[model samples]
Target: MPWRDRISELPECLITKILSYLPTKHSVKTSVLSTRWKNLWLTVPSLLLNCHDFPYRQDEVILSFLDRLLEFDPDSRLLKVKVECGGSEDIDGLRDRISTVIQRGPQHLDVESFTEYRDDDDDNFLYPFIDYIPLSLYTSRTLVSLTLTYSGLQDPGLVYMPCLKSMTLVKVHFLHAADLEKLVSGCPALEDLTLIRNMNPIYADEKVMRVRSRSLKRFRVPFSHGKRCRSSVKYTLEIDAPVLERMTLGEDHYDIIMVKNLTSLFTVDLGIKFVVEFGVFFYPGDLPKRNEIRYFLSGISSVKHMIISDKTVKAFELYSNVGMIPKFNNLSRLEAVFPFKLLQFLPAFLECCPNLKHLILEVYYSREMEDAFELTDVPQCFLSTLECVQLKRIHEWEEEEMKVATYFLENAAVLKKLTLSLTNYPRYVSDEEIFEEVNKVTKRSPACHILPDWGLCE
Candidate 1:
């Protein structure tokens, strides 16, 4: 590559296009480069501002910048507007300024309000202030995507948006479920919605928020473990999107969830923690049978692809023990991450997925499996459907682990690729010995490729 300043001779429109990708501050700074670039900043289609750009709560700089930016052109159509609210005490005054920009018909709006002023060393911004959004922003027909992350956001009453297709609300508080419902009803074209740490008032009788949109295609309810609600009332999430294709849920223990329709769902990823009875000890009676379980199992059974953590696998153990797991006729690709305790259910889960073709098992060997499962027969899928198998996090010199690995390698009739990657250094034996033991198992098909990557030992 030759270093050349010829790039500067490109057409003004092409230069503006490149400048649009830079931050608003950088775009403005480009004006000093040359006379031709002086006025080009005004044509930049996006404005991204963080409160750190101005001294905390200093309104003069922000106001002057906005005034100049807004006055640059009344007809200028903004492609994106993103602002992080920090150190502003006058909530209404800030809303008016933000409203001035959003009213310009921006296609995307991202409003993030920080609770505390963070120094340059810290990347995390704590949630503090509630941003009262101007009502006009929600009514914009030109807005296609909106993300609001404010701690105590009041409802932007009477949303009339029609062209909006995607919305995300993080830590945005609402007065009631009706407020959220009103927003959903107004967006007739909404296809995707993600709610992260959103707080909507739940009545005594109705504890959960409900989103029922015919056009909704993707839905996510990602909750962090750190999120806490002081209220004693239990809240559940209910979604009624018949056309939804992708769903992701939970990084914490969820109350109850009712997904009304998932007939079109294809993929699901969950870092799930179910609300089972808590105790310092474990007992067989603690397990809830399938009928007793307010089963989320049935709702996601129709998915073709899934990634579930060890917590999820353990949560399903009670049902698997009693053979209550529903047959996953539609599921094909599956990834199961197992903790020490959840390893027993690996074979049991395979039995339920008769059509699974791609399998990835990630084991976290952190404890002894006192109650390991004794598999008598290979799963039906291993003989007929399973084609690819990836065994990740396998520790060295474990007899039971080798048995399970050999069982799959020996019996998988239609297997094409088998990957075995060691999780740690060998305890008492070498990786070569583990390979020999695995080779002792009969290869049902000679074409199957067995790969042993023991890089951890080296």
Candidate 2:
């Protein structure tokens, strides 16, 4: 007998509670154990059916299982359904099951189809994952969060989720720009939105995708490395969100993204490795001109914290010739990844961050970068406000590194903390020469705390 047989002897309510803790698949699998466990999962509030989890099962078997599972349980209240499966498999049954769950007024709904199409006859696109989404989802008043991924060949016509607070669409095809924009505008209470791929059409009469929202606070745009080569149409994204607080663009994608009237925004993360070969009009980093780059930065000038990758640093170099970098008056924390030898431009960048209190540098060593730390004068933060510094990937002790570290130590009046870590994993920083050189630097601020524990890493 199984160890759980004793626990299964508890009352039906207690057994259902235990089953609720398990995933929908595992809970349903318990039916084979005994008659008592046959319908326990139906009493649970949520159901998650992932085809990947139950490998080698025929589509008919999966559909039959769902047919028995979703059969109307009068006692069940506030349903949550998540179905992850191949889009084209058992297409009719998948639609029926989804509709059944929606009719029950789900509080959270996620339907993902990993279906793919690779027909050479239609060679224009590589990934043709598609699903015809049901119209019933648009008008759901009970849904708090909705995530629809890899929806194929669907119009996404007129979404009206009045109670939806969070939404995510990945590889979901839309027919028009209005369809994409209306999804944002239609959700009256939406606070978070994520648009990953194919939410925009391959070509449109209009080159603008405008999203105007008052309640939105967080947004994300991510690009998949594998799908980068797949061709798609380009359009400038014009976002006008009054209360948005965070925005993360995975990479500086080819399309232009413009933000306006975002007064509450405080966090912005720009990922690395944008295609720089695109035209000057599209990608700001493509040329020495400042117009595109300047517009992108100025939109989030109110950001209080930022994380920038090396690609952005290089873009800054491209745009450095024409104009002054916008001063981030509210910025307090900055984390920058130094992939190339652009540390010399640190002083110019720091000039824009006058109120910055904490700074983190992640460097991958290049010999050219050693000579690149040329500061014409001490930055404003080094002299007064900058309190904390985190240095990552220090494999060897070099002159430029020491010079920059010593400069901060000698100049900063309010320096409170300094942390140093090595590049290699098992992540041991046992270089005595580094400690010896840094220890020799003059301590201008006695109140400054230097963390030397080898385990300390950022």
Model 2: per-residue Cα lDDT over 1-458, one tens digit each: 55555787788877876666567988878878778777677777778778766657577777787777766574455467788885454444677778778877999988887555655657675554356677777778789998888764345566788899998987666656677678788898999998765534443543576778989999888646433433356656788999999988875443666779989998988873434334222244345334556776888899999988776777675566556689998999999986547667787788899998999877656765434555457788777779999876666656656666776777766888877765455323357766766766635556777665475543
Model 2 residue-pair collision total: 2
| Residue lDDT tens for model 1, 98-163 | 888888889999988644433454756543334567778768989999998864444667787899
What is every candidate's alpha-carbon RMSD to the true fold?
Answer: 5.8, 3.8
**Which regions of candidate 2 are displaced past 4 Å?**
1-6, 52-57, 72-75, 87-90, 114-129, 152-158, 199-207, 226-232, 272-289, 368-373, 423-433, 444-447
lDDT of 2 at 196: 69
Native-to-model Cα distance after best TM-score fit, residue 346 in candidate 1, in Å: 2.6
Measured by TM-score, the strongest candidate is 2
Which pairs of residues clash in candidate 1, taking residues 3 or more apart in a chain or in different chains?
A: 115-128
Error of 2 at 119 (Å): 6.2
